[model samples]
Target: MVIGLWLASLLLALLTLLPLWRFEAWWVRGLDFPRLQLAVLAVVIVVLQLLFTDLTQFNQWSMLLISSGCLLFQLWWILPYTPLFSKEVMATAADSTSPCIAILNSNVLGPNRNAQALIDLVKQHQPDILVTLESNSWWQQQLDQLSDSYPHSVKCPLDNLYGMHVYSRLPLHNASLQFLVEEGVPSIHAEAELTDGSRIAVHFLHPAPPSPSENYSSEERDAELLVVASSVKDVTTPVIVAGDLNDVAWSETTRLFRKISGLLDPRIGRGMFNSFHADYPFMRWPLDHIFHSSHFTLQQLQRLPSIGSDHFPMLVRLCYTGRQQPQDGVDPDQDDKQLAQDKMMAQAVAPDQVHRPETQAVP
Candidate 1:
């Protein structure tokens, strides 16, 4: 009986550590909100080990290993969500009369039949731009009326989870859909012309999640995001990148992407907008994200209501106020770290030169 109890305690401890070791891997595959669960289990396992000390000789040592592992993983995993370590860039000055642009990003599950709920939500919000992921021909047909309102659009209706569609009320300039990670998995890159003539480059992406059904590892996804970040770094125009990144806000790869891209996340002082797994509130994390260049100020950030999809929509309003003056304090090593990430991105893309797909213009 004592041996069985000891084994059970140890097993629980190991189970808790498993999440810590695989948080990034699980998150990239869209299994969001594992961090909090892992933390809770770790504490419970430690208590169990302490209470059952009489059953095992090395109970304290096992508990220490479990505790240390959980804490270390949490620290490493949570760094991206903490804004103190992230750099903030202000948007370039634009005319005060320009309209505030609002974008709604939604990953409507492909198999979900409730298109009316999503259509109603979009109609209610009246966002300037609406991007939907996992949309098929059926989903596209349901939203046909939207084209009349949007005027400018991009549509890639695929049966795979990669299916993407974008609708813009504003003029879409030089819009092109490219596959950054895998063939046919589209990433929409375009420029939205504001009424005041200021152009903001937008990149919409939905990379494959890391899972047994999908890719076995997250290296491809991480490498793809890093590549996109690198592409945005050199652009002088105002930039905004949004989509289902398949990564949590707290992961190391996400932090590195933000640093390399020189983008700002509105969630800094604000709370995490955990957007995925709407069916299970307790098992949700901020998988979808909105990132903009320093040239813009956040006017509003909100998580829209669920519309029969597994993921909820995110609506963000950004105003193109003139770029503020750079603060005097600059981290000497910051640029170096960014440079390293740039190098990694370059290397990752170099090997796949043959696989690069031709960019298709949005009609």
Candidate 2:
């Protein structure tokens, strides 16, 4: 029994430490998804080692110390998302006089048949903007019903799972699809004019995930996100970067993205609001996200009901007011900028990817 427990401790310790090394290997980076689960197990082991085992033993001492440290680190990273910590983005009343922009970001699995569920969500929430990832031609046809409600739009209905579509009630200017890091993968960039005549830049992305079947490493995903971060760093306009980031809120890449781009995650004080793995409640993490600028205060950040996809839709209602006080932002240091630049340069671009996808105005 002691040997078996020791083996488990060693395995857990290794898994907990793997993501800290900045390894791009899919298996290593994949460890970032289960910090909560691992922390729970680590604490249990620590308790067992302390109460039931002989801590004087060298192996027992090592196990207890390692497990306790892992638990502390994991909790430190996730504590911000819990209600116990202060909110990173300030919240305001949803019905305030300031112009509110509610955005619903959904990754409607390309073949999922429950289109009405998503449609119902959109109708019920009536978000000013709707961004859908993994949408194909068939999904586009199904989502056409939304056009009557969201007249202004952009669509890239590729058969590839990377397909994306954006529908907005507000007028969108210079909306274009950009293939940032990988061929055939596209991200959307646009300026949305809010009701108060103020414009905020919105960048929607769904980069490929690192997996055995997908991209072998997270290089392309990290590069695409960082490249966007680099582009948005200097913009004076209010910005909203929202979509299925295919990354967790606490991942190093995401933290780096926030630091470099100077974006704020509404979920910091809100909740984990896990949006992916809708089918498996036990194996889930937040993959869908909406990171915005300090120009807007969060009115509501909620996880909408699942729409028969692996990912549940996220509703972020933000109030845009020029008077909203600037919140604390992460200033990227030289090392962060250098790391981002290196990742961007590492992603190999194809010949046709040199130009942005032609701007297609949705009628």
Top TM-score prediction, candidate number: 2
Alpha carbon lDDT of residue 336, candidate 1? 48
Among all windows of 10 consecutive residues in model 1, the one with the lowest summed lDDT is: 351-360
The global Cα lDDT (0 to 1) of model 1 is 0.72
Candidate 1 colliding pairs: 89-294, 90-294, 90-295, 91-294, 91-295, 91-296, 92-295, 92-323, 93-322, 93-323
After TM-score superposition, the amount by which residue 350's alpha carbon in candidate 1 deviates from its true location, in angstroms, is 5.0
Residue 273, candidate 1: alpha-carbon lDDT: 82
lDDT tens digits, residues 1-363, model 1? 445545655655565445435344544334334665666655665565556555345665655565656645654565444554453433323545545789999999999888888888788988899999999999999877888899999999999878999999999887778776688688898888777866778889898877878877676677678788766665566778899998888655677777767777777645678898899977888899998776777667889998889899999988876453242111225664654455456435732332221132434
Best candidate according to lDDT:
2
lDDT scores in order: 0.72, 0.85
How well is each residue in 1-363 modelled by candidate 2, as lDDT tens digits?
A: 567668778888788888989789899899989988888888888777777778778878887777788889899888887898788898886467888899999999998889899999999999999999999998889888989889999999988798999999999887778887777899898878888787778889999999999988999999888877877666666888999999999899999999988888889877899998999988889899888878889888999998999999999999987753678667888999888878887875422342221232433
Name the TM-score of candidate 1. Answer: 0.78
